[model samples]
Target: MRNLKYYFAIFSIFIMISCGENAEKKVEEKSKEETQIETEAKVSEKNVILFFGNSLTAGMGLEASEAFPVLIQNRLDSLNYNYEVVNAGLSGETTASGKNRINWVLNQDVDVFVLELGANDGLRGIPIAETRKNLQDIISTVKEKNPNTKIVLAGMQIPPNMGEEYTTDFRNIFPELAEENNVELIPFLLEGVAGDPELNQQDGIHPTAEGYEIVADNVWSVLEDVVEKE
Candidate 1:
């Protein structure tokens, strides 16, 4: 009887230990699942920025990842802000082209827009009236779809050879559209770098990497009002 009692106590202890081991494993598995959920949430906490422009915004001479939109993303990262910038630039696209595709562009879940069209139109000496009308339509469409969306219009310049009067009309288009639409205005997309030969690529049109830096800087000062990086 004494031997039987001793063996029963030993078995009870072994059963208790096994149950404890099982409970510990369950706790560990739940902890791992919680950790994974937190990681995914952290990765998704960022605003979306969309850049709609021509070859300049496309970073024609640069790699895909080195575009101005990507540069802005890098800047935001350095500032410890969470945001995603998408480049939707198409080479040789004019204001008319942008107008046609504006609806499709707004389909994304973008919180902000960098409007940089009309450069090709000005370069091609297209009618300023047509350019202005097309841009106005795009602005209206965007405002209709996402009323809270912030727009930053990138202004362009026409060659002086086109005569001062025509150039004046071309330059007026951007500011007029921006003011009418109640949006931010980037005085010149390539300010501090446009006319400089060293800043430009071989085409004397597109900016080099350094030039894009200046472009991003010009846009950065006013970008805060448009996008709140968190």
Candidate 2:
């Protein structure tokens, strides 16, 4: 009886050891899988190009993927330019609102920043001085966050409903700001798309997908230069 009991104890100990070994092996396999997934995710990460603006940037009323920024991404990808474009565009957003939200949007590292705000302010007939100041502040904040970051300012214009003076002043804001800040400027975001019924949505303000393609081209003309230098 005593001999039988000894054999049983040894068998139980062997079973426990085998179970522990299997558990340890499983744990090691899980750790390796997690590490591999993390590495893959890191490998896929690319430097960010942030597009900050209004509805035009947001691609409102269309699939988010159809937006100009994403189109820019597609362009960059096709060119083999390594960049991750982030569109932080909000519909109906004004310069003041952009100033308020700029910091939050810049929380991550931005290789390039495309400023597209102030159009809504122009549409609302906001004071040009106030619009300019808000845009200035937003730029200042961006520079403060990343001095080496490249900036591209998008110019916008409104109809002459507010008279030639207001419309002209609104049109001049972008170039003036770009010159003053030494940032690259996109002359007119809408350019070929604006005033074209075929390219515009029913509102006659926002662009359709085709219009966004032109807008993307306008932005790319300047952005490409900046990217090459970087």
Candidate 3:
């Protein structure tokens, strides 16, 4: 009977060890799952603000960090806002090009979309009707992708050298589109910097770093309200 007791005790000890090992494994798995959840939550918490546009927005002839979108990122950081700014501006990108690739850009979630395209179209004297249609399509696609996304139209105007009537029509496109689409509009992306030679680079087209600061202010004026609404 003593021998029998010893065997039973050994069996009991084995069962207890097996149970302890399983519990430890379960604990490790739970920890790993919790860590994954936390990582995903952090990623989801950051709102994406996409600055989609042309050379001016691309900060041509200047450092990328000096771009208005990067300036906006710095401002957001200073304000402690949970947002990530993506400067998707391509040099010499026209409205047509913007429309063609907008779908790929929309692949990611966008909380705020700042539209700065069409300047090249105006400079190249592309038909206003075509530019308008492209802009409309771009906005429509963005809404279709993420209806909750807020759009901010950055108004741009071509030089009067483009011609009086064409310039007027181009300038009107922004506010008209904003009114129709019910989106926010920045009156002119280069409000305080456009005509000032000091604010412009050698090409007198793109803004200098000092000029982008004012551009940042122009965008921030409208963007702050949209961000605060959330």
Candidate 4:
């Protein structure tokens, strides 16, 4: 009877050891999976980027996929990010028009704002002071809605034909606005593609597909910082 009891004790101890080892293995696997999921989520950019601008932003002359906003979307996708870019661009919209669109244009999911208005204002030769004020109001409204939202101010420069003084004033609007709003600014929205006639479409104002690629590069350079993957 004593011998039999000893054997039973040994068998029970062995079973307990096996059960503990299995439990430990399961816990380790679950931990590893959790870490992988977290890493992947961080690597994929899932933030919403709302682009508000004029004809250039609306892809006025280019196809749907040829627009800068669309190109940005493609680039983000290639990086395995989960994000959405809204082209809230109205052709020929001045700074005032952008102000009116602000309150309603903000979506709940907006994590970043790319302000590209004022180009039409420059074209129309509107007062720079009013343009600055209008842009300021839009940024303020957005900040009020989402204090943490990252902003990219898309700058514009009128042609020298607009008059040197006027062109300089128009160009300065972006930096001044950015300083006041405390946001990132792209030196030029059209950068390399604006004056290049070959890259422009028939209107010579809006960019063609090739031109939009350059525009996308300009925006992406500054926006790449706050832009994160899901």
- C-alpha RMSD in Å of predicted model 3 compared with the true structure: 11.3
Worst 10 residues of 3 by lDDT: 1-10
Per-residue lDDT over 57-114 for candidate 2, one digit per residue giving the tens place of the 0 to 100 score: 9999999989999999999888887788999999889999889888889888898999
Clashes of 4: 8
Model 4: which ten-residue window has the lowest total lDDT?
A: 1-10
What is every candidate's alpha-carbon RMSD to the true fold?
A: 12.4, 11.6, 11.3, 12.2
> Backbone clashes in each candidate structure, one number apiece?
0, 0, 0, 8
Quote each prediction's TM-score: 0.84, 0.82, 0.84, 0.79
**Candidate 2 overall lDDT versus native:** 0.87
lDDT of each: 0.82, 0.87, 0.88, 0.83
Model 1 vs truth, CA RMSD: 12.4
Candidate 1 lDDT tens digits, 1-230: 22343454455545555676557776566556555655655666567788998999899978887678888889888887777888999999988888989888888777888888988888888888999998888888888999888888888886786779889999999988888888999988888988899988999999888888888888887786676655
Q: Write the number of the candidate with greater lDDT, choosing between 1 and 2.
A: 2
